[model samples]
Target: MSSFSIRLYKDSDYEVVRGLFARGNLEHSHMAFRHAISVTRNWLFTLVMFLIPLCVTGSVILSILAVVIALSIIWICSRYVYSYYVDQCLSDDMLNIQKYYLQRDGYGFWVAESGGEVVGAVAAVPSSYSSEDKHTELKRLTVARSHRGKGIAKALCRTVIEFARNRGSDAVVLQTSLPQVDAWKLYEKMGFRKTLIIRESSLRYRIVDFVHFRYQYDLLANKLL
Candidate 1:
C-alpha cells in the first residue's frame, strides 16, 4: 500500500497543487467527452443527419459535414466548460490563498505529500451560499492520477472534515458535476448525503451542469465515528 501524509497547505506547495487541480480537471473533461459521445440521443442525431443527406442527394460531402459538425459542437462546448473551471481556479483559489482561505476564520487549505512530493489537495471555506454560520464548503478536492487508489483522496477529505469539526462547523457541503463520478462515490462513502441538484440555465453552463449534485455531511451527526 502507498503511504502519504496530509498537512496544512504551505506557500511552497502552491505550484504542485495548482498543477494537480488542472490535470484532474482535464481528466474529467476527457471522460465527459466520451460519455457525451456514447449518449443515445447524440448517436441518434448523428445517424439521422448522415442518412437524411445520403437519401436526399447521395452526397458524401454532406455526410462527412454532418459528422464534423456534431463533433465540432461537442468539442467546442467541452473546451468552454473546461476553460471556465480553469479560470475559476486561477481567479479564486490558486491566486490568493491567504485571502481566500488562510486568513479567514473557519477556512482551511490542505495538501497531501508522499516521498517529498505534493500529490493531492483539498480545501474548506466559508460557504457564501448558505444561510447557516456553521456550514463550510469543501472545494478543490483532487489527487494526482498516478497516486490515486492509495487512499490519498480519502486522507485529504478526512483532513478537511477534521478541520471543519475542530472549527465548530455543524456541517460540510460540496458541489460536483456528473463527470466526477468517482468523487461523488467517495463523498457518499464519507457520509455525505445529496442535498440538492442544481441545473444551470445559462448557455455555457448548461452543457456541463446537466446535473450538478450538492452533498452535505453533518459533522454533529457523525462526530463520534
Candidate 2:
C-alpha cells in the first residue's frame, strides 16, 4: 500500500472501490470459501491418518467425536468471518445494483457513514420488477448487521422512494427473505405491499424452510407509501 496521506475519495477511487466491492463479495468470496473447505478437509484427512495408528477402537471413536466438534467450530467461525467480507461487498454492490436495476434510469444511492467508512447503503431503480404496470424497483438494500435498528433502513428506503417518485416512477418494488421480520415491518411502514409475483427462489418456494416475499410500494396511489 502507498504511504499517501488520507484524502477524500476521488472518482477513480470510487470506481476502484466499487469494482473491489463487486468482485470481492461475489465471485472471489464463493471461490475462496469453497477452497478453504476443500483444503481444511484435506488437512483433516491427513491428521486423521497420522492419529489413527496410535488409537484403540474406543479411543478412535472418541477422537473422531472430538474432531467433529473441532471441525464444526472451525466451520462456524470461518462462516462468521466470511460474513464480514460479504457485508462489505454486498453494501458496495447495493450501490451499483441501483444502476444495474435502473439501467437507463439515474442511479440514486443513499448511504450511512461512520468513522469515514460507509456502514450502510441502499439503491433503487426507476422501474418496477413486477409485471404490473408502473412501479419503481428498490434494487439492493443492505446494511451491516452491526448498523441495524437505527432507522438507517428507513432513511435509505425513503430516500429511494422520493428519488423514484421524482423520476416519474409510480411504485417501488423489491424481494426479501422471510427471516427478516424487521425489514418486512419497515416495508409495511413505508406502505409497501406484499406482492405474489416474486420470482426469486426463496420467495417462490421454501428454500430449506425459508419463506420469502415480494414487496411493492405504490408511489402515487398509497398515501402511506
Candidate 3:
C-alpha cells in the first residue's frame, strides 16, 4: 500500500503541483476523442463527408480517405478542447497559487506527500455562484498516476471537506466534466450528491460532448465533521 501525508500547499511545491494537474487533465483526452466520435451529430457529419466523396468519384478508396479525414479532424478538435482548458487554467488561478488560494481567508490548498514527493493536490474556495458564499467549491483534486488508487484522492477530498466545514461552509461543491468518469464516482463515494449538469454550446464543449456536473456535499445534513 502507498503511504502519504496531506498538508497545506507551499511555494516550493508549485511546479510539481502544476505539472500534476496538467498531466491529470490531459489524460482524459482519449476519452474526449472517443466521446466525440460516438456522438450522433459527429457520426452523421462524418458519414456525410464519406458519402459526398463516394457519390462524386464512386471510389471506395477516396470515400475511406474522406472518412479518415473527418475522424482526424474530430480527434484534433477533441485534443484542442482539453489543451485549451489546460492553458486557461495555467494562465488563471493556477498561475498564482499563493495569491489565489493561500493568501485568502476561507480558501486553501493542500498537497499529499510520500517519501518527500508531492503526489496529490486539492483546493477549496468560496463558490462564486453561492448566495452569501454559503458553498465552498472543491478544486484541483489530482493524484499522480503512479500513486493513484491508494486512497490518495479520497484523502485529498476529505481534506477539502474538512477545510470547507471548518470555514462555516454549508456545503462543499465541485464541478467535473463528463470525460472524468472516475472523478464523478469518487465524489459520489465521498457522499457528494449531483446538483446540476450543463451542456455547453461552445465549440470546445460540443466537440468533446463535454457535459459539466456539479456535486455538493452538505456539511450540515451529514456528519462529516
Candidate 4:
C-alpha cells in the first residue's frame, strides 16, 4: 500500500537491522508473560498459594502479596526466555550477515525500504533437514512497528519465497512461536501449511508455554515455479 522496494541486504544496514530486530523482539514480551501466567502449572501454583494466605489467616494483605509474588515469578521466567532467544539470534547468523546469507549458496537476505529507510527484513537459507529435497527455510522476517500493516511484511515474505523458487527449492519452510500469532497467520494466508508443532525443551521456554510451529509453502503444489 505504501511506496517501497525490496533489495538485497547491504553492509550499511547492519546496525539499523539489528536495532529493529531487538525492539521488535522485545515487543512480544507482554504476550510471553501472559502466556506464562496462563500455563496450568503456573496458574495452579499461584491460585493455591494465594488461597493459602486467605484460608490460614484471612489476611487480605498477605493474599495480595502472594499474588504479587506469583506474577513476579512468571515475569522473570518470561523475561529470561525472551532475552535468551534475542541474544542467540543476534549472536548467530545475524552477527555476520554477509557470511551467513550473502556468501552462502541458496541463501539470501533482503531489506524493504520505504522513503529511503529500511522498514522490513527477511532471509532464506537451504533447509538443513530437507536439503536433498531442495527446501528453503525462511528466517528473521521482521518489520518495524511504525511500518506494519502496510503490506511491508507480506512483500518481504514474497521476496524470500520468490528467491527460493528461483533457486529450485521445492518448498519454503519457516518456524514461528506461539507468541507470534500474526506471523503464523501471514504465513498461512500466503498458502503455507502447518507441518509440525514442537514444545521446546528449554526450562525457560517450558515455563513460558512456548511452542514452535513449523510451516511449509510448497512451490510445486502451488505451481509457482
TM-scores, all candidates, are 0.92, 0.53, 0.95, 0.94
TM-score, predicted candidate 4 vs. hidden true structure: 0.94
Question: What ordering of candidates by lDDT runs from best to worst?
Answer: 3, 4, 1, 2
Best by TM-score: 3
RMSD, candidate 3, Å = 1.4
Model 1, 174-195: lDDT tens digits are 9998778999999999899999
Error of 2 at 99 (Å): 6.9
Which pairs, if any, clash in model 2?
A: 136-171
| Minimal lDDT window, size 10, model 3 | 125-134
Model 2, total clashes: 1
Q: Per-residue lDDT tens digits of candidate 3, residues 1-225?
A: 887999999999999999999999998888889888999999999999889989999998999999999898888877887788899998998999999999998889999999999999999889975685779999988999999889999999999888877788889989998889999998898789998999989886786688889898999998743
Off by over 4 Å in 4: 131-133
Candidate 2 achieves a global lDDT of: 0.56
Off by over 4 Å in 3: none
Ranked by TM-score from best down, the candidates are 3, 4, 1, 2
